[model samples]
Target: MLRVMNERAVFGEIFRLGKVSRPELAQATGLSKPTISMALADLERARLVRPIGLRTGNAGRAALLYEIRPEAGWVLAVDVGREFVRLALADLVGDIAARGDERRKGGETPAELVARLGELTRELADEAGAALEDITLTVFGTPGIHDKETGSLQLAPNLPGWERPGAIELLAGVVPDTPYIVENDVDLAAVGEGAYGLGQGVDHFALVWIGTGIGMGVVIDGKLYRGAQGAAGEISYLPVGEGDPLVNRGRGMLESVASADGVVAQAARLGLEGLTSAKDVFDAARRQDPIACQVVAAESDHIAHALAGVIAVLDPELVVLGGGIGVQAGDLLIGPVTGRLRDLVALRVPMIKASTLGTEAVLLGAMAVGLTTARDLVFERAVAQAPPG
Candidate 1:
């Protein structure tokens, strides 16, 4: 029951050369002129492809070339973190039309957060000259493990009381009938980077985020490699130190040394006052403050040590540094981490780079998920509306 000829004409031409003319599609797909014409017409009508321009270099007649349409429908992406929530409205080509952020106050309930998201989404849609209903789908990236079977946040350390019944269901209820997806923030960021940013064209890579907490996302062969329990890259629990009370108790080893809060707390213990946040420490380091510089250097070294283990195990081609703290001090961390890694590994060294997307990576990734979902939905509709075989 497959429309083999039609699908071949469309996908074969698109994937082979990224763009194609009708005659070229016909030639490559081995379809008759009439069949190619009919298929292209249907695809254009569905807004899957659009005329780019007329091609030159022909003696007799010029051929009109076509490209994939990136704005058939909009995608909404949300990145929910412990301190703030960032939202973006993007087209199919991954262009953000409108963006905004809101600070998260302590003790905010899930229903309250969902209502705020609805309000902000409505505002953003209006700013982008788009309607809420026009958005094909929505994806949310939060610091939590989502249970797909029940649509619940199984384990979210940052958001207290966020796993109650109907959390995702209630959020979906706000925008009636709109498709919604929920995923871990780090995983979404990795996907975003791989699809549209630094990880583009690279197959195997690791994205490590150093912020309120330390976490990672692994990509293998161009796809997110979530382990069997959907917690593959949760590296915060890796044991590094032994017999130390602070290192062995509560949060895991990597988080105690590499996270922003961990750095700040360590700085305080070292008699450094007025360093209330990671940004303060970074600024102090920029100002040539010795204590702040030492703190950041120590944290970077710890992260590098942890990454050495990851490299020994996964052998990724690239390691991407991200998150608020990571992006802010990428220059400082990259050199030290790379140096420490060299000491630990003897073989080929992986390219260590900073994330180009910054804090927006997770949001953009969520949008990618939404756009892909919309595309799949459209394909399903086309299949259902096809003529009986």
Candidate 2:
């Protein structure tokens, strides 16, 4: 048991330092030379870590450097959104081996969608020169709350068959051992920001997605906070916005007034002609159309009211505006939203910023989430390969 623990520690060090020498591992892990040697031998035998090169130019004999084998584990990240389904396969070292992005044709059943996903996964695996079973873990970044007990996705009205009882189960069978996860797309976006975007190093923050749908993903103390029922940041249900909250009870209050559809509805109600989408409204606002500007203001007010509620409850250190409308018109919305947010809140205002990653946020976040699980699973498998331990 001690030997296995030592091997894991050494493997962790090598994983962290990229490539490390035995003596360096010894110093880093505070283990003696023989212990480092044993750990390296175990890891090498398991094909988890290997000597990449030599640490030369030293005072004494050169030391061999080791690194985690990049092919030892694989992660498949899927972004199942309203319009697109994206798949990416990455190796242990975070190199994307292959990727597929396709616009989802409207009206496919859950089973058909799962079949399409399977076909894509197999194609990408072949493209990457990896077998179908090589995927160690799969993470699906999708909208709505996934119920573990029932294995059903809740509140995902955008994807028709996704909320069905057996829909998400099919995703797990894409890889070996049925190792997979279905996480809220917005929550995964928060993870992506922490890994590669604006929320990096932020201990507490929220990724507010205002687009075709409205939602928020909260990260507290560097961990995604899925509330008791795993619906922590369903800010769309917020009741603080204008108009009757029950008017769009099916879609929630804030979502009804602040989502893309809401923006378009506001444009029409405010007398803006022929703007079918929020994108058009924002473009018209940029072109200085008076009614469109008023629509933007109305949208901003609705969003501000919703955000004020979020701030009062969560008190995140920062808020990152994301999704289609949030990213495209974020610059426009940020100023007005911030101004309104300032007036609406009594506490110190959190910094508001636009997502740097744009559409890739959820996909990247799924990778991050998968990597977290893959790391542990891979490490345990490697440790298990040690002789007599």
Candidate 3:
């Protein structure tokens, strides 16, 4: 048990430092030179780590550098959006080995998407020169929160039949002989932001996605805060938009007025011509179309109202706008949204920024989540291969 703990510590230090010598590992891990050597030998035999090269600029003899082997384990990330399905393969060190995307067909059912997901997994693995069995962890990012207790997706109206019982089980069965994880797509986006985008190192922030759907991913004190029921950021249900809440549609009230579909509906309601999509309305607004400007202003107000409520409750340091319409109309909306926010919120408002990760945020987030688990799993597997006594 003691040896296993030492090996785990040494491996973790190596993973954290990227490349480390025996002396550095000993200092970082507080283990003696002989103990570090033993652990390194075990890790090398397990194929979890390897010596890269000699550190040339040292005072004494050149120390041998060790690094976690990139190909020791692999992670697979899948992002399923309303219109697209993206897949990426990452190694132990977070290097993307393969990635591909496919357009989702209209009216595609949950089962159909699951089938396609399985196909994409195999295709992605082959592209990366690995077999399905080579994947250490598989994480799927879908539109709704996965109910771990019931194994069913909840609050995902975009993909019909996904909320049904056994849907998660069905999705999990796609990857043969491998463990699979399902995470909320928006939450994954927030995770991606923290890992690689504007939210990096921000202790408290929120990623609000205003696109095909409406949702928010709240990171409080550097960790995701899913509510007691895992619906903390389901801001779509917030009654901050037009119409009565009692007449609840399938999608939430905020979503009904602020999503892309909502933008087009608002344009049509106000007699705006030729604006079929939110993108079209934004484009027209850029050309100074009066009608489009009104819709955009209203959209901005709706977003501001929702954000005021978020700020009143969370007081996040930064708010990141994401999703289809959110990213496209950020520049136009930021001014109005922040202006209206100043009028609404009592305290200081957070700096609102456009998502640096954009649409790839979910995929990148899945990769981050997958890689964390893959590291632990790979280390445990290696430890199990030759249990330390």
lDDT string, candidate 1, 1-389, tens digits: 33544764575376346568888887888887788777777767666668899999979789888776766667889888988999999875556889989998857888888889899999999998888887878898988678766767865767766777656687685466888888899999999899888999999999998888778999999999989878888888777532223332456677876677777877886778987888898888889889988987888778877887899989999999999888898877888889888888876779999999998889877877776787666545555665655
List, residue by residue over 1-389, the lDDT tens digit for candidate 3. 88889989998888789988999999998999999999899999999999999989758799999999999999999998988999999999999989998998858877788788899888888889988888999999988788888878888876788777777888765687788888889999999999999999999999999998989999999998888888889999899787533233788888888888888888888888776789999999999999999999999999999999999999999999999887998989999999999999998989999998988999999999998889999998887788535
Better of 1 and 2 by lDDT: 2
Q: Each model's TM-score? A: 0.89, 0.95, 0.96
Count clashes in each candidate, considering only residues at least 3 apart in sequence or on different chains: 0, 0, 0
Candidate 2 overall lDDT versus native: 0.87
Q: Could you give the candidate ranking by lDDT, starting with the highest?
A: 3, 2, 1
TM-score-based ranking, best first? 3, 2, 1
RMSD of each: 3.0, 2.0, 1.9
Kindly report which residue pairs in candidate 1 clash with one another.
none
Candidate 3 residue 358 C-alpha distance from true site, Å: 0.9
TM-score of 1: 0.89
Candidate 2 segments exceeding 4 Å error: 57-61, 242-249
